[model samples]
Target: MAANFSNSLVRWIDHRLPVFSYLRHAAYDYPTPKNLNYWWNFGSLAGISLAIMIVSGIALAMNYTPHVNHAFDSVERIMRDVNYGWLIRYIHMNGASFFFIVVYIHIFRGVYFGSYKSPRELLWILGVIILLLMMATAFMGYVLPWGQMSFWGATVITNLFSAVPLIGESLVTWLWGGFSIDNPTLNRFFVLHYLFPFIIVSIVLLHIVALHRFGSNNPLGIDIKYPNDTIPFHPYYTIKDAYGLGVFLILFAGVVFFAPNFFGEPDNYIPSNPLSTPLHIVPEWYFLPFYAILRSIPDKLGGVISMFGSIVVLLLLPWLDRSPVRSGHFRGVFKIFFGILLIDIVALGYLGGKPSRGMYVIFSRLATAYYFAYFLVILPVLSKFDSSRLLPKSISTPMPEVNGIE
Candidate 1:
């Protein structure tokens, strides 16, 4: 009787609002490629990470003070005094790193499989926009604690705007809401930090809608040609994603419980002291590659442009690679280049964390050069000549069994 009543209620709502029908079509009945692999799991993982961040952030904000004088103490109070505050703070702190890790993997998977090609160009662009927004939101949130790194890091990064031609200083002043980083800056950062996540959520929804329109690209990178090439997203991919989430949560829990400060800088433990600058100042790990690029160039304005251009290049990727083939799996030489590109990026990230001196500068310059060349020169040139292997007819095509499993 209860089940029948529930079914009837759902039917009544579906007849008017259709929310149930919409969810059923979008989540359960959506057609997904049958050949998707573990790499695809990162997309769903990123969504879950976003949800965790939002929930934990709100909880932390309830006890956080945005004023510079009290911000540091408030964070400490939450860590020591508030109920389950330590757990919430740790989860929120480490969740940022986990979120970036998932999103980066998702991006690389897209690039590797040509998920950015053809009909999905806008989808790729939207993803890049989300990345930019995430960067901004993270930067703002980092300042909320009002620690040593938070203050100086904010000072240095906001000063980068001074490289703009005419309105640079004005823009910086406006950003700070004063001549320098002070109470106004902290308040502004706090408000924006609280606000940007919701903006990110909105973009995420649009991203989902965009993704569902074209369906997901698979490991094979071939277009679906038959009913057998696809499976319902519910029982198949949903179960696969949940399994991935379980593994991810284990790693995340280990970090949160065992080494909550793994990604944090020790300098941030100290309160902000404008009079005493630390020996070394650096942004978060996720921002390192771009930071390296920013410092690589000698000219301040040039460095700023190069750093921003690095992201702009991603927006142009759909057009930059004029290749007919979508997947790196089918492109032999391109695969080798892609491997080198990944190594170069990792090297840049490592160098970003190091002092901008001696061998670090040299390597950063080389990596930065290769980064642009890979997209602007190499991809365009290779697109004209690189030959791809013959692709499978459809996602349902059978392959020879490996290790005699079949």
Candidate 2:
């Protein structure tokens, strides 16, 4: 029986794809430096999280129907009646949060390791594209509940098309498919919500392929040139990556099981009514920083441009940092400037959650300008001449762990 099975497998391979071509590629794969740590695991972890979302989302759609009149109640039924309904809903919801958490860490890892420079620029750019698609998917998912925030949030966001100079009003009307946010808007969002994630998955797979082609960056921000500094990709780093995955999953499970709604808006529970509007309409927590940037300027068009400019600036980052070095690690002036950038983002998020006027507005404009200045002005200027303490090449000891990261 074993002989027969082996013979059949050989025959199948011989009959189908050319066997030698596949085997050679598999066995003698390109060399990957084994020195990579948990930071490298994020690409794999992010891939896993995205898979979970797609699977759970498909399960939900089997039960969910898309109609303005029925959409909200359909979800309520799923939560109340469907088997493992609550579990699936919680997983899908929390999965989005997990996705963002992993991606942000992935991006920061890139920044620290200088993964965004040179040949990997396309990889980083594709990652940003994936991030945008994820945001679009999440935003449309928010609208499906047909809640108070969902209705107004859709209305406000889609209306931004009106900020366009020549065709603004027509664009808004075209988006609405009527005078206001109605059944048409809900229907379109449902179609898009289902579609965008699949695109994100494709982009993510390409991201990994692109990353693997160039290998990965290290904490030292230097490619391994000597045998002493390198290791294999299999055993050494795989174990470390698994450990990180386990810890991240524990936190994810805790949120889904204990505090599923903690990241959500309370106003979303109320049903949407066109005539009655919520006192405050805001986007999700993740989008708050950009939202703050949007409302900072009084002019609608100007605010829209500024809001978009925040993300557009990220594309220029590879070129903007003129330093031969990749990280702020050794750069004295850059470290202080880096901290200010983080604080600036937090300030914007805070202001985004506040009402649209007064001190929040004043503070927002200043932060927005500072945001551009850091990327456009400070980074290039400081990279060239800043003097810093540098450990000698002989200083080869492993660095001390900071907050569990090596």
Candidate 3:
């Protein structure tokens, strides 16, 4: 009866706006690979995280004052005076970290499954664009609190633009709205930070349209040959996505309620003091790997170039990886290198948080070298020689049952 009612309502709505029909066709009735694993859940997880951030951010913004003098006090007032304001603020804060976690996993899954190949290249590129936008949004949002780290972080990052040859100084001045970071910078950052999420949403719609056009890449990295090779996105994958969401929320809630400041810097708790800089100014954890890459270079201009290049290099991934087979499961040699790259990135992230001198600098340089090599040299060479495992004929091919499950 419920199903019939839903159908009837959808039909009635379809006659007007067709919104229900679009949702049903694009979401519920969309054909997805049967062999898609839990890794595929991250895309939906990312979308959920984005929604959480947007909603929590809207609530927090209601009470936020985007000013240099009052910004920090405003945040304190939210925590101490406003109704359940702490909860909203904590969710927004922690949600940023969780958002990146899901996105990184989603990107890694795409790399592993060869989701960027051929028809889906545009889809992958759109994902990278979203990532760059997210980084900018997060960085601007970080500055809104007008805390010590927030002030210095904004100063350090904005100054990087001054590394440009001809227009560097003017660009920095324009960005700062003066000789230094101040009220104008803070106000503009707040405005852009609030605006960028909606921009991300718009691009995400384009990303989804591209995705639906090509369909999903499966674990096997093979084209769907028959109806059995695919399944409706509704019941099967929706349930899986729901389970992933529950687990993700558990972790997010843990951080929000139990370890709210675990990912935050102690320096951020202090109000911005331009005269008294922290001994070592570091960015949020998610930017650490690239931060390490930036400092690894000896020259300032080179470091800035290298830092931006690390992200820009990802744009070339679809072309960099020349392997005939898409899935790392089949490519024996590529899998080993992929693991090494993961370890190298984690090592860089750790080293990024520490003082950038002595052995730390050496290790960071080495890791940074390998990081570029993985994309530029390792993938191109290995693609030609890596031995691959035999794949099943189709996504629907039944394998030996694991324990008694089909």
lDDT tens readout by residue for model 3, 211-268: 9996999888888889878888988888999999999989999999999988899899
TM-score of each: 0.96, 0.89, 0.95
Q: What residue pairs clash in candidate 1, if any at all?
A: none
Model 2: residues with Cα > 4 Å off, grouped in runs: 1-30, 34-37, 386-406
Q: lDDT per model, in order?
A: 0.91, 0.79, 0.90
Model 1 misses residue 130 by how many Å?
Answer: 0.5
User: Model 2, 1-406: lDDT tens per residue?
Assistant: 1222246667566556556433433233434555565777788788889899999999999888788888878888889999988899889988988888798778777766668877778898898888888888988998998989999999889888899999999999897788888888888888999999889888877887787776676665555565556555545556677788899889999999999998888888888888898999989888898999999989999999988788778777788876776545555566778778888988998999999888888999999889999989988897677432342231244544422253
Candidate 2: residue pairs that collide: 34-231, 34-232
Q: Which runs of model 1 end up more than 4 angstroms from their true locations? A: 1-6, 387-389, 399-406
For residue 350, give model 1's deviation from the true position in Å: 0.8
Position 133, candidate 2: lDDT:
87
Model 1 per-residue lDDT at 125: 95
Scored by TM-score, the top model is 1
Predictions: Cα RMSD each: 3.2, 4.6, 3.5
The better candidate by TM-score, 2 or 3, is 3
